[model samples]
Target: MSEGLSAARQRDLLIATTASAVITDATLLPFFPKLFATAFGVEDPRHVGLYLAATCLTVMLALPVWARLERRWSTLQLLVVGQLGAGGLAIASHLTTELWSFWACTLTMIVFKASYLLVYPYVMRLVPKASHAGVIGLLTVIVHLGGILGATLGGWVLEHHDPRAAYLVMAAGDFLQMGVSVYLLRRGARAPSPEPAHEGVPEVVEASADDPAPALPPIPQRLSPLVRLGLLMAVVYFSAFITRPFFVEYWGTRSSLDGELVSGWVFAIPALASLVALGVQHMGWSRPGSLYKWLALIALGVAIQATPLPAAIVVGRFIYGWAAFRGLVDLDLALFEISPPERYAEDYSHMNLCQQGGVLIAFWIAGLAVNAGGLVQPLWIALGGFVVGAGVFAAYGSRFVAAAPSEGKAPEEVAPC
Candidate 1:
């Protein structure tokens, strides 16, 4: 195949990868705490806690591997192999009855699932830079929506059928994605890397014989403000996922709590809230209002969990859904604005690493909190984290935005996450 991505081909990459994003996250959500009993003999929250911790480490370590491999091979190629491998692992984990077998297979699959990290760059390169935020937002929506669908499916399957059935569905979904990736490979033209607007221009300066040529300023190799913003985003994402794994068990234990399936719906409220946030954003809601609004929503969610009331917990989650979506999406857009199109993959890989690090820390805190006080402490931790993140952004965001060379930077595009 020759280079240059077609519009239809970009669409395929987006659909396949977005679905891939959904299945992996969705496949894992409902199996925790509830399903741990059947496979591990101990249904304690600690097991799920430990498992998520392991996922944190596995993906953290594995993401860099994918990033490195992408430098040498095709991202689409890695995605193809990763999907098939992850699919087989999902299916195999379903087959294994042993706890050790399950954990090993599941965690290993996450290592492969790290390939999902590359999809950002995969689609980023496939589309023009101008559309980056829109694509990212749509992908973000699909991802959250996937979480809803996955959790609902997992919960429903567990309620009616065997827990393993959920994995089977995930496996089927993975294979379908793999097929899509393969078709993109076989039929689509090889997408060309972007060339800078001034790439071929000669650096000519008119000078008189008596006038010596002035030395040119060096191109900036490092963007410290952008790096700082990236860190803030990492924290935001970390704060977002900190309490995610425990929602089912957290809400399920309440006296007024409905059932496993209902827990999925409860978990899904944030995604719905996210859609609302996106609509508000699309409608030209004020940009300056982002930081305070984001912090408030996050604080509300955490405070709700802290209340000891189950109904409060539900209310908080909805508030948090909106908070997480807007905060994460805006921060990502900030990064997009600062990034160069040529370094898109490399830059996002670094961003991914930072976000993964935050998630890893979240898991560590989550595991400890679960061990100490059931599941409430992590919310406290996440709340504190959100506070720190919001402060960091508010204090430094304007400076960072000011730091950009207006003419040098890419155009800022707004999209949902």
Candidate 2:
């Protein structure tokens, strides 16, 4: 609805911010037992899990504060501030040898890095409602690609140099993000301003002609649509992420090939799965209404990965990746489809906080589980999460249908909290 910039400029901004997002994921996703051991000489899975959970906690605490700042500053402006702070803190982390000092610097770095999340909703605002699923699909794929790249790079760094060198890579990524944000801000400033619109009037963007209808029904009038969606996504994310932190370690235990590089490649199986799924999606063969099927596949995949065989683990990763990419994209599509353009940034921030909460809890439990029962335990926990999540989704499905807004009406009108 904002007319300050043209569509071309918006596309350019999305592209630049997306590149930053890829780098951010590449730098951060590699954090876990390997990088933690390298950086702090701490190899205990419990402590490693705790540290990863703490990062999520940092992001959770910081997200709302950054969301509130959007009222006073554009997302690009905030990104510049965030990236500069994050980049500096990342360097500070590299300089520290003490565990607590490094923890302090890295956690504070996450606080600033949290601001870059605004790019998701900000970009969603720039495009038509119809293209939301396509965009979300592409972004999901990028996340997988970043994960693949990060795992490989992190492995190489840990193998060939001081493991702590990963922090320098993180710092470099943050600086590059900062550069992109600054360029966007300057470019926006130089563009001619559009004619002023009426104050206190909200603009409604028409739904795209080809845009699919909302995936599920609306929630009750007492709860907001975004809130309901966020809760549902939280559970789904928890199921998927419970196995994430210890995946490399798990691979190391099962496979005869035991170097960091091989483990990295094994760890990236899901990303490779995402690539195959993306190709399938590109061929227009993916079913839009198969959310339930995707969920079932995910549960089966988790079960398969829990087996003792390394080959089963690799096969399971591909299954999980394919289902997860489709399922997550569908959920995101559902989110934006029901949301009004005016609330994109605010709504997305709220949803992301819920997501972080889920991941936070998962990380905590994974550490404790691995400590108690060894590496294989978390996959079973993840399978249980998927079952619970699917149940919750089914339980809530009817309510959403009952409260769904009529065509062309904003979800707020029907589902306000």
Candidate 3:
């Protein structure tokens, strides 16, 4: 089976890379309130939301810099640096005595952590285009699954230890990622490298008398389809996150749940649904048409969770679980449909910048709504915003596909040690 698994090593590395994407977020999810207490001397989760927004602000600021760095360095080299740097900063973050100090460390840490995003484009060079969807699907599954287990275990650590312990857990993941990257580099396996397609913005070609360059569309023309889809997906995620940081707080307010650990289960339910969707998707049940229905259902579920009724929140969350999974897969498929194989990292980074923007917006609103208004206000925002986003998604449905198909296939040969 190992011999038959062509590119199995690459596949393993991709999984490892994807694992880095979710572990910290999931591990840290259930401990936000505690972190707030440690940093700001408060028990309010609203502070957690604000801090999240701040971290994302740094992530947004760093995106272009990382994009440029990717052009200069190999993916493995960047991964090693990102992992070690983030791991060090993460550990340092735990030692902060005040909110400002913690924020400084965390923001720096995120800048390094963001390097994980480059791995997807690098791995695309190793597999067939027909396999891209499957690879992405499995990658998504790993993401949610990592979050699920991380949340569960995180809740446990919070029960027995301090919020700072969660940071330690995150640091461990960074170290592990660093170790994997080092192994890959030591093995001397290199991802297929692509030439620079374009720089910071879309470039206009200059035609010379000796060689007439073909006139091509500007960046906006090239990125519109994916950008529209990205905005829609961002809305959904942004809306959802508005309420996510406070799930444990909300559960305590609305239900008889004892602590954040118990409420973490509520958070994990949707991830559970994602796993189910992945299984069904794995069994050849995926369909592009499902995107529309999933969006509508997600909007509905968000509305339900936002209502005053506790039972509705539970039921709504279950539906949300299923819908979120399908929507995430659909959005990725949509991205894949339009993505240039040669420019996967560049293109996806742009899309991710959009997603991060959504997260930033949601977290800002979450901080505002929860801090100044009411606990349920973010849910209302989510309810309204998700519908608006999904509506746009459906409206754009008739036309969405890559301008051209990706010409990627199995590596003709890879650089080996």
By lDDT, who's the top model here?
2
- The pairs that clash in candidate 3 are 338-402
Per-structure clash totals for the candidates: 3, 3, 1
**Candidates 2 and 3 compared by lDDT, better number:** 2
Between which residue pairs do clashes occur in model 2?
Answer: 217-400, 217-401, 218-400
Which number leads on TM-score? 2
**How far off is residue 19 in model 1, in Å?**
2.6
Measure candidate 1: CA RMSD.
6.7
TM-score ranking, best first: 2, 1, 3
| Full-model lDDT for every candidate | 0.71, 0.76, 0.72
**lDDT at 374, model 2:** 92
Candidate 1 local distance difference test against the native: 0.71
Candidate 2 similarity to native, TM-score:
0.87
lDDT tens digits, residues 221-288, model 3? 34356655666667767876787777777777888874667777777778777888777766888655
Write candidate 2's Cα lDDT for 9-122 as tens digits: 765666655665575556446456766676667889889788888998898889888988987888888888998998899889878889989889989998999998888877
Candidate 3 residue runs with Cα over 4 Å from true position: 1-6, 43-46, 193-223, 284-290, 308-311, 400-417
For residue 289, what is the lDDT in candidate 3? Answer: 57
